[model samples]
Structure formats: C-alpha cells, structure tokens
Target chain A: MADETTPRLRIAVVGTGLIGGSILLRLHEAGNDVLGWDPQPAARAAAARRRVPFNDRLDVTLKGRDVVFLCGPLRALPESLTEVARLADDGCVITDVGSTKAEIADHAARLGLADRFIPGHPMAGTEKAGLDSAIGSLYDSAPWVLCPSSTDALPGFRLLTRLIIENFGARVVPMEPRAHDAVVALSSHIPHILAGALAGAAAGSAVKQAVLALAAGSFKDGTRVAGTPSSRTADMLISNRAAVVAQLDLVRAVLDGLVASLADADDAELLRRLQVGRGLREELLDRSMLPVTRSFDLARDDQAELDFLRRLGGDGGYVTGQETDATTVTYTALATR
Target chain B: MADETTPRLRIAVVGTGLIGGSILLRLHEAGNDVLGWDPQPAARAAAARRRVPFNDRLDVTLKGRDVVFLCGPLRALPESLTEVARLADDGCVITDVGSTKAEIADHAARLGLADRFIPGHPMAGTEKAGLDSAIGSLYDSAPWVLCPSSTDALPGFRLLTRLIIENFGARVVPMEPRAHDAVVALSSHIPHILAGALAGAAAGSAVKQAVLALAAGSFKDGTRVAGTPSSRTADMLISNRAAVVAQLDLVRAVLDGLVASLADADDAELLRRLQVGRGLREELLDRSMLPVTRSFDLARDDQAELDFLRRLGGDGGYVTGQETDATTVTYTALATR
Candidate 1:
C-alpha cells in the first residue's frame, strides 16, 4: 500500500491490542521497519504466533524508531509515552490511540515533548477483541483524530498524517483536544447514560413485564454499551467529565423540551421536536450526499493554515490527502457554518 | 352516561369483522338476545349464514341493547361509538374491542359516555379471520382487559365483566384507562422517544462526521426505533401522554444521577447505578429467572378488589382464569410490594 511518496518508516507500536497490533501489521505490510510490544508476555506471544514483528523488551523495541504509536490503555498511555519519548531517537514522531486527549496533552507539554508528541485517537474497533482480530485494513477510511498543541508540532503532525494518508488509508482530523472530548461525549458517553437510565427506568416500572416484552431492537441498541462492565464504562464516562457533563446538559434540555410538549398536549410541538432529530439522523445516514473537499496551502500564513485546519475539524471534516512536500492539505467536509 | 339494566342482557355487535362477528356468534349461542350489524351487506350475509342474528338497520340493531360492542378498526372506532351512543338506550353498556386504550377513552369521555364506555382488549386471535372464523369457543379462556374510568363506571364495568366471564368464557382484568396507557407508554412510547433523541443528539454534535463513522452499535441501536414514521411516532407518544411523561421523568433522573457521579468523580456510585441497570437488563433477558407470583381474592372486599385490579394491571399482570361465577378472579402477577 505504500506509494512512491512514502518513505520506509521505522515504526514501533506499544501494546499489542487491536489498535496496536493492526498498526504494526499495516506498517510491516507497507514495507516498513516495524516492531510491536506488550506488557503481557502472553499477549506478545500471541502476536508472535501470528508471525508479527514483536519484541519482549519494550524499550529496545521502541528504540531508533522514526514513528512510535503508544497504543497502550488510557491509564498506561502517559507513562508509556514518557518511556517512548526517552528511548526513541529525537526525530521520532510519537502519537497514541486513546479516546480522550486533554490530560495526555498536558502531560506531554509538562514533559516538553510537544513537538515530538502528537496526540491522536484513531477511531477504529471491531466486535472481536485482542490481537487475533487485528487486521491491516483496520484504519482504512477511519477518522484518525490528532490534537496539535502549537505551531511547533506542525511538522510532526504533517509527517504522521501524511504517512497515514499515504499508506494506512486514514482520514486525519486535527481538532482541539476539548472539542474532541465534547464530540465524543455527545456521540458515545451520552448514549451510555441514556441506555443505563432507560434500562433502569423500565426495570422500576409497575409494567416492567410489559416493557420487557415491548423493548425490542431499539432498547437493545440503546443499552448495548451498558452491557460493558460497569466500572469500565464509569471510568470512560468520568475520565472526560467536563465534555460529558456539558453535552449531558444539552441532552437534558432536549428531553425537557419533549416532556413540556407532552405535558401541554402539544402534538404539533412534539412532532416538531421529533422531526428535528429525524432530519439530522437522515443527514448522518445519507451516504449518497458526497461531502465537498476544500484545500489550503500550508505555505500560506501559518495562522491562516492553522485556522483552516481548526475550521475543517469544526465542520466535521477530515484531511484526506496532501502534496508530497506537505504544502497543501485537502479535506472532505460540509461548508463551514 | 347510562343507568344499570337488570341481569339478563340485550347485546349488539357492530362492524361484523373478525372480532365483531365472533362476539355476535358467541353471544347468540349463549342465548343473550344478540344482534349483529355490518354496513356491508356481503359481510352481514356471510355472518347470517353462520347463524349470527343480523339486522339491516344499525339504529334498529342497537335500539334496545343492554350492551354494545364497537369492534370496528382503530381509525373507525370513534365514529362508530358516536353513532352507537346516538341510537342506543341510556341503560346500554357501551364497550369496544380496541388495542390502545387512551385515545378512545379520551373520545368516550368527551362524548359523556365514560360510565357506559369501558375500553377492552382481548388477547386472543387465530390465523383464520372474519365471520367464518367466529367460533363460540373463540373467547374461551382468553384474557379480556377492561379499563374502568371511575366507580360510576364500575357498575357498567361489572355488568360487562360478568357477561364476558360467563357467556363469552373470558377472564376479566380491570385497569384504569390512564394506567393502561402508562403501562404501554413504558413499554412502547418511551423506546421511540429515546431512539429519536439519541439520533438527534449525535447528528447535532460538532464533529458529527467523526461521530457518523465512530458512533457504532450503541448509537445505531439507540436510534433504531426512530426509523418509524415521525408523525406516527409523535401521535403514539402524544396519545399516551401522562404515563410517558412520568416514565421519562424517571429516565431523566437516572441520567442526572450518572452525570452527578461523573462530575463528582464518584466512581463507586457510578458503578453502583450502572451495575443496577445491568443487573435489571440481565434479569429481564434471563429466561431461567422465573419471577414469583401471588394472587388475592376478588370476593373478600369489593372496594379492595377494585384497588387490587388497578394494581394488577399496573404491575403488568393479567387475568388468566377465574371462577365461572365471577366470584374469584385468578391473575398471573409478580408479588406486590
């Protein structure tokens, strides 16, 4: 998958879970020098059995790498990134695949690795878990989020984004760390709360048997994440409190609006509220409506370029491709509001 | 709207459809002086051949009846009841075989027929339909639900319950009209509300394109029921207003609790709440978890029996069997607190 523009990237992927293993496999298949690591020997052995390029010593595996992806668990990422920053060459572009970004961005800043440490969250997963489910195409067409702290980190961001666009088939989205959290709070965290609440509310009803019989596909889908171990879901929800809480207030408003409409016997208002969501949902699901792409040359004023990237992310756009020299970046998106 | 007639009853069945024809056939066989009317000659002629007493004029058919069964389609029930109330004598016990109770109950109240009009739903059907399928044994052992509006309607409700229990071979369960609506609201209306809201929230997120790609099973499933036509969903929710509003309040509280826990960094409380819902959902899903049931006597205290009947329907319980004399009602239910 490596085109003529791609350099032979020396990449190390820490943590051989789905994201790490997939990143390792994809880079290795792209004719790169790639190595994988896992804190657990059993996990490393499992990947090794798959004929993956795996090493037992994480520090040695991370050494001399041009690109190091810290794909460890959220709790382990900060320490692991510190280790990767310490071992890998000063030229190494470090990134990660964690759901949230702000806390880690703060840690990277305090460690003075802003230029080398590019925070990322590649939006990819499968129902299956662990290394066996890892595939080379995991990041294909997926949105890989990047939170660039300042103008100094532009080169590292460009290097990793270009490599991904060229070989891994990822769509790069450069967003503010907080914005990423807000978006996920609406999309992921709120749904979990709604799911548990719905299940809980129904369970307490006098007509629970009726609810059980009637709650079919919708109830199941809504509550699917509540099935995740409670402590894990709580950790994820609590980890990004500000975004999750702000978005939850918005949700409470939406619900309160519905309740008021019902209380007033306002069928017209009820229909209006219900229709707003329906229209938006239809837009989200509308595959036929191909989004337009806009591009800006990085050679322009640096502030202008950064502003464009931020606007692109704000517009729900992602960088799809770029000039080999990294002068211009083109992204697919709706027009900025 | 009507006074009580003596024990011996004059019964009439309107619409001559599957349910109407069956009621006519069964009541005529039990020697209740029954009459059947169908606006369509073909349907009535067909029922006539099946030995169902037919009257060409609906006014004459309904003139002297002590009980009238408005077994028309949902869309036609309101108009049919209006016509029946116009022609029937004041003492007539007006009832109907309709699925959802709230809308028609509201209409009956508007028509000042709340005392006479008791909404009913019989959980019995076959692959076969129409007058030809009208067997005297059709309602045998079937659960017939009666939504009693008030104690003024209790006499009418009692008369109909006795008739259905004796001649129709039915088991009677009395529930308040709004309570029945609430029961169904928790089961059906609330799911639709949740689905639409979840979809709407995601579509409005700032990084919605990322959300579109990343909000997987939970997002899709949560909004799955929202695919139902908007006007249709709105109408269903609005019709069952009180119950849905109350239940949605409970849902909002649950969501608020999760938000507070996340805000306070109270992982333990968050886990406790989430685990409660998870346990409830699993219990709902567990086929092996047979719930305990307890029944009370209907003859012991008539006043208490009314309250118990309300509780039974509220508890998602149903009348399964009864003493043929209607002295003791046997219901399937979870133990009441």
Candidate 2:
C-alpha cells in the first residue's frame, strides 16, 4: 500500500528536454525524488547542470523508479517505452507527454507494457524545446489528458493522475487516446503544418525576403507553430499519420466548398460562409481557453477623430466626447443603433 | 496648373462611412473646406448635429466642390463615381478608396471620365467600419496605391496624388490598374479569404460560445479581415475574381507540396520547411512598415514572449541572468558546433 503523506515512490524521466525536463523540474519542486536519463549527451549534460538527478544509463535510471515518463517526440516514444519495459524494474508505471497518444498507446501495448503504461498528453508547450526550456510552472493551469487502456494497472494510473493534478497544478481530462489524437490533429497539428507550408512556399521564391516583409500579424500568429524544430514536427506527422491525414481531408473538403461557392458565383453563400467564419473567430477570441497566446484589442481612442472626419464630410455623424487622457481615446455610440 | 499655396480646396466626400468619414475629418482638420453627403437619414442627422456641413443630396454637395472622393464599398463606388463624373465641373478631380482599381478605372474610362478619375487604394483600415469607426490619422504614413492610365489626364492624376499625400499624410505609389488588382489580390484579398475559410473549418461543432472563449491572438489576427462586412468581402472577391482565383491556386500548390512532404515522411525536408517558415515569419515581423494600430501592441508583446521562449528552447542553451531590475534570458552557442 502506498502511503499518502510519506509516499516513497521513485520516478524516471526519459529524454529530458523541454517537456521531460519540465516534468522533472516540477516533480522535484514538489519534493519528489526523480532520476533523469537521455540518449543525447547534451541533454544528459543539461539535466546535470540544471541539478536534475541524471543517470547516463537508461537501465540504471529505470532500475528503481516507480513511474517512468517518456517525454520525447511521438515517433521516439514507442521505442523508448519498449526499452523501458524490457529493462526497467517489474511493475514500474510508464506514461508519455507526446501530442498524439493513440498510436503511442497502441505501440506500448504491443510492446507488452500496456498494463503498466498510461498514455497522457500535457496540452501545454512553447514553440521552444530542450532542457533549458523547462520551467517549474510549464504545466500550471494547462490541460493534461490521460488516455487509459482497459487493461492498465488501476493503482498506478490513479497515482499518476493524482501526481499530475496535485504536483503540477494541471487539470486532468480523460478521453480515448484516438479521440485525443484527432482533436489535437485538427486544433494543433494541422494548423502548424499549414503555417510551415505557407511560409516555406513564400520563402522559396525570388521575392522571398520581400514577401516576408509584407507579412503581417495574421501570418505571424497563424504560423507561430511552424517555428518549432523540424524533427519534432516530422515525428508528430509520421506518428500521428492517420489523424493528421483525416484532419487534412476535412480541411480540403472545406476548401472545396469555398471553391464551389466561388465557382458558382454564389455571393450570398460565400458571404454566409464569411459571416459564419467571422462569428466563429469572434467566439474563439472571447473564450481564451485554447492554446493560442495572442489577443486582439479592438478599441482605439482616436476612433472619435475618424468619426469627427465623417461629420466634417457633412454626413451628420457625431463624435463621442469621452477623451479620458492624451494616450487613451474612447468613442461612445453617437446615435444608438 | 495648381498653385501650392491655394487656400484649402473645397472637397465633397460621399458615403460618410469609415473611409469617407475619416477622409473628411482629416481634410477638415487640415483646414480644408469639407462637406459630407450620405443618403441615410440617420447618418445625415448625426453629421449635422456634430457641426459638420451635411447635405443629403449628392448633386448639391458636388456643385461647388473642387474634388469629390468616393469612399464606400466597391459595389457603391462605380455608381457614386459615375454620378460625380456626370455632375461635377470638368476641372474637378475625382478619386476613390476602393480595393479594386482595374474595374473601377475601366468603368471610368468607358464613361469618358478617365482623366477626371484617378483610382487609388489606401492600404489602411481597421476591422471596424462605418462613420463611427473613422479616425483622423487613418491614412497617416500608409501606402496609397494610385492607378492612372497612360493616356489619362496627367494633371488630374497628379492633383489627386498630391491631395492624398498632403491632406492625409500618406505616400502615393503609382502602378497600373491591373497590376494593383493582382498585388492586392495576393496581399489583401487572398489573406481575407483564407482567414474566413480557416475560421469556418476550425469552428466546427464546438459550442459557439466555447470556441470563442478559446480563441487567442493568432485566431483574432488570422480572422481580423473576416469581421469586414459580407457585402464588401463579396464585392472584393467577385470584382477581382480572376486574380483571386490565381492566388488561391498558388496557395493550393503550396498545400499540396506540404501534404506530399508529410506523406513521404522526410524528416529533413520537413525541418527545412519549418526553418524556412520561421525565418520568413521573423523577417516579416521585423520588416513590416505599417503603422502601429490597435493590434500592434498585443502582437508585438506576444511575439517578444514567443521569441524569449524559443531562445530558451533553442539549440544554444539558455543563460539566465539579472539585468538591473529585469530578469534577462539569453541563449548560448550549442556545444556541438
């Protein structure tokens, strides 16, 4: 029986980069004894410098740890998990922070670690990765989805979830692994892929620099995820091939609908589509729940000056009299709708 | 032959909407004799109450004005320009702030008023529209693209350009009407359409309210253009159908290439694409010359944070230090190289 207050559980964190290192940091911050291991020498060095307890040997890192978190690219997770299951102490719990969990979970089960492995994805990250990127508060207020297989060890699963919520201050949501993968493919993966593609096409041209010069906030925001390392991105696409492809198909269908509307000269339909899009975009803005990091400010104090111009044009427009201060301008409704 | 020091010329602006109202306010602020004309009874009343010279009849407003600026949706521009061209004195110069130039210019030329009409598009606007949305410095330092036919009256074109620069503090760049249409299609029209389409697809099935809640800065910027009126967007797309279609095709080709890369599972190629995108996005942020408006602060600050996060996760590990009162973050060169 695990003691609630004096829990003597050991944890192993593999591939100690941004996500892994962050897990380790947060775990340590919570007073947990953790062992860190990575195949890359730099990563191992990084863990040591950051005072993350490091073992160069994976087997040594997993020898006594009660739980092992596989925090690597989606493609790398399966092999790493397999290695841990083969060499680690019997009954050690394993989980992952990979974006796509369905395939990883399936691979873990195939590698005979299903009963001990729980597929979990922390829905938080910066475009940046690596050991130095790790922070104690990375998972604070973020959603961490736990996808458990039917045959998974119950006590181990519950313990992992409890640790995530209590230690990391994260909200744990349970869902089917495949469903988690699909949702992320639509919300996160596809958008990143598209942004990268758009940027790549623009950059490969003769006027590449000029094209970038003309880019605005929209392009920057839409393509922010494209700045992530290619290896990580590639691993995501390859591992989550089925889900990403499905999302792309949906995107293509939507594009075709738009093309049809344009081709049919259906302005009303096109306008409707635009209106729906605008409404949806506005809704998204209001929620602030998604992982998007930007915000839109619509109010400008100088708006009255514009209204005053319209009035001067003899259109019988009224300017709002709310000038709070020099740097701040506010316009009230001239005539109520 | 126009004298530089001639007392501010009388200008009549029709529409009293965002563009027209702004121009009128700017002209009046510059000490020009400006009058606004709008058919909407409420609009005319509002303008009159604001002490602006308001006239409901276009003919009365156009009678003595030395210039008439058509500022409205594209659908309204051709008729407004035609009306002014028919009524205004032969010497009166006419211009517009419409998005498409070729169609408007062609209509003017066919109407035998090409010399009097200098098609212009001021590359400045907010997501908001209508007279209430107008602001004094709307066109300040913004690019005003001028499309003047070769055989058109040169003096009239020059006069229009001068007025744009002097009255609104905008810089005018002259180009052919077709070229202007094409460029705007790539820069403005295509972006708007893509934004609308993406928002439409992403808004799928998620509760309208929930979707809005989760939206962050990127979604807002990406969908900023979608907030524009459906009629205006429809007109823009329909009026510049050929060019827009071409741009859409280009965008599709880019997407196709990305899909192919993903299918091939080429990690190297994928990384190259992402790096290229990152470089382009960064360059664009640095090179953008547009005025800082409402969206500027939010985007700039968010971008700075993202950059900070990226450097922390970069190949060159982070070096955290204190700089005076601020916590400074720096990246050191990778040990591998």
Candidate 3:
C-alpha cells in the first residue's frame, strides 16, 4: 500500500450498487484510482459499463488498494468485510457505507481490523436504488458520519476521513457507533417506518382510489423513501432494530397524545402538540443543520438568490456570511423550518 | 345577484385568510368582482392592503354577491355559514373551504341553507398560512372537492361550481360529504399525524442535533406539513375526529406489522411490507388522481414531453391525444409513486 507520499489514493469499492457505485464514481471524479467489485454479474457488468475500473475477483481488487469500502447491504456487510480482511493488503484502511454502525464495527473488531476500520454512513440517499440511481455528485454537500473504532488520532482513519471530507465535499462528523445508530433510528429509520405505514394504510384502505387521488406534495415527499428497494430497507431496519424500536415507542407516544386530543375534542391540547412539533422544526432550522449552500458575491446580488431566499419553503432557511465590500454570500437552506 | 347573463360574477369571500384570500385574488384576476370580509382587524387590513375589496361587515360584502364562500377553519365554518346564510342575497350559492365536510353540511342543513350550500374543500395547501401566504395561483390545477347538499340541478350551486372549475382552473369532483370526510381522513389527516409524530419524536429525542443534521429529503418532505400552524391542524383533526381515528387505527395496524417484522428480523416480511407500500404508491400514480394539465401539439414532437413521459417519476404519467398531426398532447404529474 502507498504511504502518505502518494498523491492519488488507490480505492476499492466492494459493491457497485447505489451507495457503492456512487462513491466510486464520485471518488474517481475526485482523482482517486477506484476499482469496483460486485458479486452479482449484472451489477458488475453495469459498473464496468460505467467505466468503473471493474475487477471480477474481490481479492485482486483489494490487493495494493489504499482503502477497501465494503459497500454492500447491512445484512451482507459482516461477511463482506470478512472477505475484505482475508484478501486486502495489510496496513490498508477499511471502511463501510452501512446504515447501522455498531454491528459492523463489532464484526470489524472481531476480524482483528478494529483500528483500521472506520465505520462510515453517508447521510444521503434517494428513493431510487441500485446502479440505475447512482450519481457522481450524490454525496456532495451531504453529511458523512464517521464512527472510528479507535480514536480519530489513528493516522489511517484520519487520512481516510480527510479524503472523504475534502475529496467528496461531504461534511464529516464524528460520533460513537452506538450514538450514530440511535440518532439515525430517530432521523432516518423511524421516518421510513412512518412513510411505509402511511403508504400501507392508504394502500390497504377501502378509499385507496381517493387516497391516491388526493396524495399531494407533502404526502409524496414524506413517503418518498418508502419506495426504496424492500431488501435494503429491511436490512437497515432489522440490523438497527433496538434503536428503531426505541424511536417507534416515542412515535407511538406522540401519536397517542394526538389521538387523545382528537378524541376529547381538545383543540388546545392538539394545538399544543402541533406547536411543539412546529417549534422543534423551527429549532432544527435555526440550528443550521442540513444546509443547502448558495454562494454569490454581494457586488452582484443575483435575483435568483433573492427569489430562492424569498421562496425558501419548508421550515425556512439559515442565511450566513457577512457583507464585506467583496462579500461572497454563502447560505445553506438548512432544516427549512 | 347576477344570473348566467352577467359578464362577471360578484363573489364574497367570508374569511380573508390563506384559502379565502388566494381564492379572492385568483378570482379577481379572472375578472370576478371579489369582496372579502374578516372579523379580525389585522386580517381585514391585510386584505385591504392587497386590494381584496375588504368589507369588515359580512352583510355588506354578501349583499349582492352571486356566491358567498365561507373560507374559514373547520370549527368556524358552521357559524360562518350561518352568518353567510343570514346575509347573502336570495339565490346566492354558499360554499366553504373547510377540511371536513359532513359536520359543515349538517350545520348548513340545520340552518335551512343546505339547498344553497355546496360544501367544498380544495385539496391544496402549503405549510404557510394567513393573508401573507395568499397567492393568486394557489388553486391552479388543484382538486376542488365539492360535496353539494343539493344536486347539480340547483342553479346557484351549478353556477358556483362552474366558476370554480372554469375560472379558478381547479378540477371539480363531486362527492358525498361523509365520503369526502372518509377519503381525506386517509389522504390528508393520517399523513399530517405521521409527519407531526415523526417531527415530534425526532425533536424529543436525545440526539435532536444529529437528527436535524442527518435529516434527508424524505424526512423533510414527510414532515413538511408538521410545520403548519398548530391551531389550524388541531381544528382539522378535531372536526374530522371519527374519520381521523379510523385512519389512525389503520396506521397503527400497519406500524405494528412493521415493528413485528423488525423484531423477528424477518427480512421477507419487511420486504413485503415495503413492497406493499411501494405498490400502493404506484397504483396511486398510475390512477392520475392528482393531475396538472399540460398540453403540446403533435405536429411538433416535443422532446421535453417525451422525456417527461419516459422519465415521469413514481407510477408514470398518462398521455392523451394521438398523433394526427393536429393532435395536442396533455399530461399530468400526479400520484408520482
């Protein structure tokens, strides 16, 4: 494996699905020499078609690679990493794009690659999945969570983290593996459950036609992730069951409160519950979490920027950057509250 | 009140809020003489500022109007319509923009105004509300549900319906008041509950910061409606309590199944649940329940139109008008799965 002196990193993407393929494509665009491997013949062929430096043999792909990213599904990651450990060169940093981190980290630790394995979860996805949905810029401006098995002081982990943040243009954030799992359970997994349940309820209803007819922007956007491939969604849910269940319990409590308010015709209580949700959303927006960056020089205040700011729908937007004489206005349309 | 011979209809909007103000603005732009009334001094002043022909006195606004629209909250609609009934000129149709229809229809019947009351709910809203959020094109291509107490033969009701469909450009669908309530409970109420609960759960979580940071597009869209003012949402929920509760039960059952699937680590069950939701969403898109009209001539084969049809997200789109060289293509991006 090349040392820090090497200018271009050698990267191996272990699966050419949505997350894996997108990562490879993006890293390749960022000047990394990326090799890809997917067990499925069609998937590998598709990656090859996209000119993703495909290698049929996983062992061959791993050899001499600076880092091997096990970008397989949650259920398959443990075994995939095991194979990576067996085949990959020593001193090479290992990472993953798994949804849940604790189990993956434990598996890496048991395989004697704990310190080298930085469990990463890019907080980015689309309703679509697989190679067909892979885009080179998917991870740009996305939050990439890294839960290092050891400390970030580890050279290999730090180098890999820097590469992801700098090359991929992702905002790298550090957290404990358990904390990552728990937070995503509330933010990602439970929302999927909510969407799936809504779609299921509507699908199962006698008024299915009407429900479909009336489903508007809110319903569609809210339930968009429910359309993700079933296998992938299931893997994430089951692998992260404890956290998701904890979030579900909270969801049920909130729902029960709403139901009680409805039953009692307590408008005030219902209003309070709704207000609490709205206030939380506003707080989320003001916190500047998940911002969409918009940059423009103050000398030429673009009408598009103004319109974007004015029409900034959802929670609202967070406007940052000061007005120096030659000020470049950089704003992120964050948790638009 | 003017008859069919009148060049422009004189319309009185009883509430100068989002729905009412938008309707007034749009109708005024469509050449209707639109007058607005609101008990709130601020709302009245705002409407007047927008040149909404604000009349603080309801009777003054309704004196000679062809139609009186009681555009207020579900809770206030009964009283608003009662006031409209007392003031509106003889033979003038009365309608409402309340989310729930059954209770309002009953109230109208009790007040001896059912024959002239066409209970309506335009299935269009944004998280923003009040006079400030009012826009002229808000109802364009949106579904305007009408639960007419009397049949279409009623002159006043038919005239108002025609004006809404032809002038406001909203798709007018006739439905029974109870049926409308039942359908919307599934389509609108349950989705709001899902959004609010998700936002509330995320907000109440220990990892609110991380949840906000990691929140993606689906989560944002899924929880968008939760940003709506608490009072308004509570009113909608309470007025449609029975239907909302029924829908909530369905939601609970679906959620329980998903929970069980996760607990058992039953990948197949989880996949089936996700697929069911996906399939329902697909069916919704295919049905073209919510549609926007787009037209193009066949003589010029529009690449954009073709791309729109092929790349039509969700369940796909409906294509109409054959290639007779003189034919025009029309499509709607509805129920995007």
**Over the stretch A246-279, how does candidate 3's per-residue lDDT look in tens digits?**
7788888998887888777777788888887888
Model 1 TM-score on a 0 to 1 scale? 0.71
lDDT, candidate 1, equals: 0.74
Q: Name the better of 1 and 2 by TM-score.
A: 2
Candidate 2 falls in which docking quality class?
incorrect
CA lDDT, every prediction? 0.74, 0.65, 0.73
**Candidate 2, superposed: residue stretches over 4 Å from native:** A1-16, A21-68, A83-92, A131-141, A151-154, A167-169, A200-229, A275-337, B1-12, B25-35, B42-67, B87-89, B137-141, B151-171, B202-229, B264-337
Q: Residue A115 of candidate 1: its Cα lDDT?
A: 83
DockQ per model, Cα: 0.32, 0.16, 0.29
Model 3 chain A: weakest 10-residue lDDT segment is: A313-322
- Chain B TM-score for candidate 1: 0.63
Candidate 3 deviant stretches above 4 angstroms? A1-8, A40-52, A130-133, A151-153, A288-337, B1-8, B40-57, B151-153, B288-337
lDDT of 2 by residue, B100-165 (tens): 889998998899887778887777777676677678899876656666665344446545656776
Candidate 3's DockQ is: 0.29
